[model samples]
Structure formats: structure tokens, C-alpha cells
Target: MAVRMLINGVAADQVPALDRGLAYGDGLFESIRLVDAVAPLWSRHMRRLVESCGRLRIPPPDTMQLWSEVLEVTRDMPHSVVRITVTRGIGERGYALPAAPQPMRVVAAFAPPQVADSAYAQGVRMRVCDIRLAEQPLLAGMKHLNRLEQVLARAEWSDPAIAEGVLCDSHGRVISATMANLFAVVDGMLLTPALDRCGVAGVARAEVLAACPQTQVGALTLDALLGASEVFLSSSVRGILPVRSLDKQDYPVGGTTRQLQQHWRDLGLRWSRADE
Candidate 1:
């Protein structure tokens, strides 16, 4: 639990009570994986953060400054996770945003996933929750601070055996997993659900699409997901994770998953390593 948390480049314990991020969840966050004290996905995280800030109308922090803080807070750590949160600073009592809102940035570091390599090679089991994501076109792909949907969906099950939960839209179209982007291989084509209506567009998903130009993004149904030849989850920290089983049905960690994992490793995203 030896970690350092900084608020606006200085050591601090808490944010202002009137901060809009705490008041109305007016904020954005990026979880960066620091492998060997390096963040290979820093550019991707910065791109998404800038996009989210523009979408949310919050001012984006200086990319170089943010990187400096990332390294500053996570110094000397061999393997860790650095989470950067940008808030709309303190605001008035009403819903109206300030005309000149100053954004507050918080950087904190913690231990990375401790799951064994077997979890990635053999695949992890996930569950489908009853809670459906309400379509919000405006907030569709932004990783804003509001995560009550994922919180409640994750709360739907407490089985330690379940590594993650797949979420769908109100119309039963699969979107993504609770913490990672979902991907499936169907008819020898890589497919992932379109996130124009819901779900966060994870950084790792962006990388996969960039590397595998043949990948397609569209609506994915639960039946379609179950019918796929292979399934996996992508995230900044974990890289790629094959899905072994979805509830009662079983899926092997097929070649497609291995190929994508190898691609990530070749790209020098050290977090891609499934082994410690």
C-alpha cells in the first residue's frame, strides 16, 4: 500500500468539497500501466484524455506536464498502475459550469494486476449481468467519472470465479465488458461492438483496430458473441485477455487470441506480458 497521490503536482490527501468532479461527476480519468517504470501507452491515453476533455468541455492538461507527474509519482516502481483524474475544479452550487473553470489533476499509483499468466493463456471466465447500459449518445465513448452503471453491474455478482462481466445496451446488443473492451472472432473476421451508443472506447481497443486493419466494429448480440470462434477483452493494463467461458458455455483460448497477444508484445507494450 506504499503509494503516492498528488493533486495538481503537489502532495495532498483530498480535493475541494465543491469540486465539480465530486459534485456532478464532471471529470475524466485515464488508467496508465507503468511497466518497468515505463508507460508505453502514454500517447494513447493522452489522446483519449484530450478527446474526452473536449467532449466534456473540461480543459485538458498539458500533455508534457501530465507525463512528468506520471513519472514523478510512480518513480522507482517496477510494475504499477497510475491513474490520472482531471476534474472541473471547484464550481458554484448550481449545474451551470463556470465560465472560466480551472481543471484539477490528480495522479496516483498502485499495484498492477496480480493475476497469473495462466489466467491469460487459459482464459478467464466472465458473467453476463442483468443490468443493461442505458444509451447515452453524448457520453457514449468517454471515460468520464460517472461509473455507477459499471458499479451496479459489477455488484450484480460476487462470485470470485467470475473475472469480469459483459454488458449490453437496453436493446440487448452487447457493448463491452465492465472494465475492458470486448472483441470476438466470427467467420474468421475480428468484430467488436460499435460504441457510438454506449461503452467506453478503450485505448487498447484503439491499438488493436490500428494494427489489425481488417477488424470490424458493429452491433454484436449475445447470441452472436456466443457463436464466435474466440473471445477476448482488451485494456491498457492487461493488453489482451482471452475469455475461457461465458456462464455455462466454454471457449478455448484460440489462435486469434494468441496472435493478438503476440502482436501487442511485438509492439513493445511491456504490459502485454502475460507472465510475471
Candidate 2:
């Protein structure tokens, strides 16, 4: 490995031109946070990767081999982010699957995002995106390579003040942020948007639900979100981040959000202070 990246167990920076991931977006990816070169949620990520591969009809990579590759790429790095990408490999010019399929795996490591301490302490600002998510039950909840919806939603805002963008389904139900899962405390009960119809069911969201047993998953309206006493966004890389405001509606950084942040820290994941 070239200290940062590996392509199919080789030290390379590019994949074949006919790769299906680039040609048709036939792949899945996972972004894992590394603390002291260790991934605390490795098993959770691998479980999702295997399940998604089964759904996409692509052969899953061996978990042990992938972990070795992850270690090789992130060696000596105190804190970083590693992305694992698995694609259908090179294929012909059409949509048919290759008779003998060859899956491509790419593991790369880089410095973690520089999120300020205040983003976790004081909370971050968010905006409601105009782009609505289309419901697709078959493809829901997997971090597949095709992400044009999130691309358009994130493009709606370029202001440095906005930390994230909220995405809703066509029926006006809040689904998630452009890059994270949504959570709101409504009437003293923890609620998250149900992903049965659409939206990605993130690993961090699962962890939150596990730690906070009172959480309820169902349809969440934009009005309910604005009226909630607390709101937060969860991501594998960013961990748990409280939403201080959405558009003009403001929310306080409540106790539930603080408790979850401690839970994230206890798991050896740090988004705001990577050095510590």
C-alpha cells in the first residue's frame, strides 16, 4: 500500500476505465473513523457491507482481509477516516452482469475533517433543502454509490454558516440531512424518521437507538421537527451533532444530545477533537 491507498490489494490510484462503479455506479461504500488506527465500529460497518453486497448481488469481500488492508493504509496515523469502496469491477459496455464477476475493492485513508469543538459543544446550524428524496424500498438504507439526490441537496447551500441540510420525501416527511441521519425529541420521546420507504439507516443512528431505548422510528413532518425540543444529526464520521437551528427555527442543545455525545466518546470515536 502507498501509505494512503490500495486498489485491489495493489498500490494504485486509479481503477480500470470500464469499472462498473464509475460507468454505472454499481457499488457501495463505507466511511469509518479511525482512532489510534483502530476502528471501533468495524464489525457494524462490515455487517452492513455484507448485507448490502448481498442485496446488490455482488460477492462480498472477506472482512479479515479488508481489515488488514485498512490497517496497512492507516498505519501510524493517530486519527483519520478510511473509506472502503466495493464495485462490480470492469464490465462490458452494456448493463448485463459479467458471467465471471470480479469485484473491485478500494481502501483509502486521509486526515479526518476539521470540525470545530463548538460544533459539538454549542451545536451547528442547518437548512431545509428543496430537493425531495424519492422513495425506493428496494434500494433504501444502503450507502450505495449512486447519490445524485444528496449531491443536488448539498449543492443548494454553499454558505459557510450552514453545517448541514435537511432532506424530506416527496410527501413532505423529513427523512434525513444531506449527509447524516435525523433525530428529534418530540413531546419528550426520542423520534427518528423511519427508513422503510427511503433514506439511509446509518450505523450511528443504530447506535443511538441502542443506547437510548426510548427512541421511536416513524414518519416525521417538517412541522414536528421545527416544534421539537431537540434535534441532532448522526454520521459515522461526524458522530452525534446537535442541531442548534434549522432555517429560522432554533433548538437548544438538550441533555439527550449531550448524553449521546458521551456515548460516542466512550466508543473511542472523536469528530471534534481528533488529537485528544
Best by lDDT: 2
Candidate 1 Cα errors over 4 Å, as ranges:
271-276
Instruction: Write candidate 2's Cα lDDT for 129-226 as tens digits.
Output: 99999999999999999999999998998899999999999999999998899899999999999998889988888888889888999999999999
Query: TM-score, each model?
Result: 0.97, 0.97
| Residue 238 lDDT (model 2) | 90
lDDT of 1 by residue, 47-98 (tens): 9999999998898999999888888888888888999999999988999989
Worst 10 residues of 1 by lDDT: 267-276
